[model samples]
Target: MSPDADPRSAPTSPRPSGLWRTVAEIERHVATDGWGAPLRLFALVRTADALDRDPGLARRLPPNVLDEARADPDHLTSVEQEGVPAVADLDELLGQLAWPDGVDGAALVVERILVPPDAETEVRAVTAGDDEAGRARALAAHPLAEDVRIAVGVLRDGRHECAVRSRSKDSDGEVATGADLVPGLVGALAATLQD
Candidate 1:
C-alpha cells in the first residue's frame, strides 16, 4: 500500500461486471492493432482501479508503481488466498495460466480473486461468481477473484500489497477461455493505453 492511502474509504456499491467488456475490448484492439496499445489500456484501467480501492496510497502511484509492476509481473503463489504475501510477484502471465490454457468460456474458478501486483499494490474487488479473478482469469473465460470479504496483506519492498486470490474451488482453480467475450476488456484497456 502507498504510505498516504486509505483502504476503508472504498465505495460500497455493486461492482461492474466489466470482465466481458474488458475482454472484448482487449481482443478487438489486439486483433486490429497491436499488443502494446491493448496492454497500455489494460495497465491504465488496472492502475486506476487499484488507486480507487486503496486511497491511502502515495497518490503518485500509477506512473511510479507501474514502472515496476509492468515488468515485475504478478505471480499466483497459491490457490488458497490467505497464504500469499501481500507484496509478492505473480508467478506467470495471464496466458501462461496453464489452468485454463485450453478451457472455454469465462468461468470463475474461484468465487472472487484479488490480484496484488509485485509492486505491493492491491485492488480490493468483489467477486459475484461473474467477476474475473485477475488478469489471468480475465484472459481465461472462467475468471477467478477474491472480494473484500477475504483479504490478506503481505510485505515486499517494504510495502504492502493485496493478499487474497479467489478461484472457483469447484473447478479446482483451472482457467477456461472467454475468447468470445474478452475483446471488451482488452479493447478498453488498449484504448486507454495505446494513446
Candidate 2:
C-alpha cells in the first residue's frame, strides 16, 4: 500500500471465525501501514447465569454486583485501563482475571489508532544534517492525528472481526482506515485467546 493509501479502504474478506484471524489481520495492517500509536483495549465477560440460580453464590457477592450480574447475565463487561504492557500480557491478563460471582466466557476489543505520516521527522532530520535535532524538534511542534476507528473484537467463542471507520478529530472529513497504527497491540489482544 502507498504511504498515502488507507488500509481500511482496502478490500477485506468476510469476517473470520477465530481469534487467530484477527491476529493475522493486525499483522498484515502493520506490515503495510507501519505502526503508529499505543492501543486501548477492553475486555468483555459474560457472567454466569447461575449467580441468580445459586443462592450460595449469590450470598458471596456484593448485593449490587450480584443484582447487576443477575440483571444482565449474558453481558458483563470490564475494561483493562492500562495500555497493553506487553504482548505476553495478552494471555496473562486474561489468565489473571477473576470474575465476580458469575462471569464466564470473555472477549477482547482493541481500540484503533491514527496512521502517522511516513518519516515526517526523519526526512527532515537527514536533510538538516548537523542541525538534525533542531529540524526534528520543529516537526514535533505541531502534531496532527487522523481520526480513525479500527476496533477489533475477539469473542469468547473465538469469533473475531475488525471494524474500520474514520473521520478527522474535528469531525471534518470521512474516510475509513487506522488499524495500521497499533498492530502489535491487536496481536497481543488476539493472543489472549490463541495462547
Candidate 3:
C-alpha cells in the first residue's frame, strides 16, 4: 500500500475495529517500501488525544481522518519511532521496551522468512549451531522458505490485531488480517504496555 492510500479503503476480514484498522494501515504503509527493510516500531495513541496534543496535525493528516477521530473515541494514530537501536534478537528488543503513560499501545512491523512446516526439522538442524547471520543466510537460501512481513499491534486493554503479507503475494488485497494470527508476537507487544 502506498503512503497516500486511504486506511479505510483497505479490505479487512470479520469487520475491523479501530485498533485493527490502525494495524492494517501500518502494514500497508510499510509494504509500500517493499522487502528487506529493518524492524519498525510505532506508538499508538488515541487519535483524539494526538490531535489534542498537536493541533497542527489537523492539517497534515489525511482528509476526513480528523473528523473520524472526533467521531470515534477508540481511533488510534500510529507514530513511527525513529532511530531504533539495531538488535539481533526481537525478544530482547521488546523485553527492554517500556511505553510511557501517554502511549495507549505499541506496534511492531518485522520481516521474517518462514520455512514450510515439513522442512522445519531440517531447517532447525541445519542452523542449530550457526550464529544469527548464518541462520538468516541459510533460511534465505532455503527453497521452501517464504518471506513475510508481519505487523502486530497491541492495546493496553489487551486488544490485539495482526496483518501478514507475503512477498509472493504482495498486495493490499492479499494481506491477511485477524486477531489471533500471531499470538506470540502479540504477547510480546502487549508486554511492552505492562506496568
Candidate 4:
C-alpha cells in the first residue's frame, strides 16, 4: 500500500475481531505509551494469526519487524505510557520499511513515467524495458500524478523526479501505528473507493 493511504473502517475481513484487537493494541500503545507485556504477548500471537492467513505478504512485516516490536518493553505499556516510545520506535522501524534507503530517496528506475509537473515533459514508450510500463501505469493511476504521458524515449537514464506522487510518503506508522496496517488500509480503501 502507498504510504499516504488512510484505511477506511474494515468491515469485511475474517478477522474483524482480530483487527479490533490489533487496533486496540495500537491505541493502547499510542495512548499510554505502555502497551504492557500482555499487549506485546498478545500482539505477537495476533500477528502470528494474521500472518497465518496470508503467508505470502511479508513486506508489511518483514522477518525483522518483530525486532522493532521488541525494542521497548517499557514503551509497550500504554499509548500515553508507551505511546510515544512505541510510536517513536515502531515508527522508526516502519519508516525504514517505508523509506528503505534511509529517507534520502529510493532507487527509482522507470521505463515509462508520465511526468507529473508538466504534461509536455518529454516521454517515451518502450516495450523492451522491464519496469517502465508497469510503473507508468501505477503513476498514471495516482491522483497526485496527473497530466503526464510517456514519450518513447524521454527517460532512458532518468529515474524518479521526486514529486508529490510518491509511493511511501508517510512512513506508514507516521500516519497509522504500524506498517502492518498497510495491507488492511489498502484493502479497506480499495473496497471503499470501488463502492
lDDT tens readout by residue for model 2, 1-195: 899999989888964333333333443443344334444455444435454456586567667666656655443433444654655244566555443433332334333334356545544645656775575455544354344445565554444445454534322132223344345545555555543
lDDT of 4 by residue, 1-195 (tens): 456665664355553232333333443333333212221211112234344455654466655654533442211111111232233232243233231111121111111223454432323332235666555565566555533111010011121111111233322233222223234222322222121
Local accuracy of candidate 3 as per-residue lDDT tens digits, 1-195: 899999999887754589989999999999989899999999999989988888998999987888889888999999899999999899999999999999999999999999877676676677757566777787778898999999999999999999999999999999999999989999999999999
lDDT on C-alpha atoms for all candidate structures: 0.29, 0.46, 0.91, 0.29
- Lowest summed lDDT over 10 consecutive residues: which window, candidate 1? 101-110
TM-score of each: 0.18, 0.35, 0.86, 0.17
Clashing pairs in 2: 47-103, 48-102
> Superposing all C-alpha atoms, what RMSD in Å does each candidate have to the true structure?
20.5, 13.1, 7.8, 19.5
Off by over 4 Å in 1: 1-16, 34-48, 51-195
Between prediction 1 and prediction 4, which has the larger TM-score? 1
Better of 3 and 4 by TM-score: 3
Off by over 4 Å in 3: 1-15, 126-133
lDDT of 1 by residue, 86-124 (tens): 222222222332222211112111122344352112222
Kindly give the stretch of ten consecutive residues in candidate 2 with the minimal lDDT sum: 169-178
Residue 112, candidate 1: C-alpha displacement in angstroms: 29
Q: Model 3 scores what on Cα lDDT? A: 0.91
Error of 4 at 105 (Å): 29
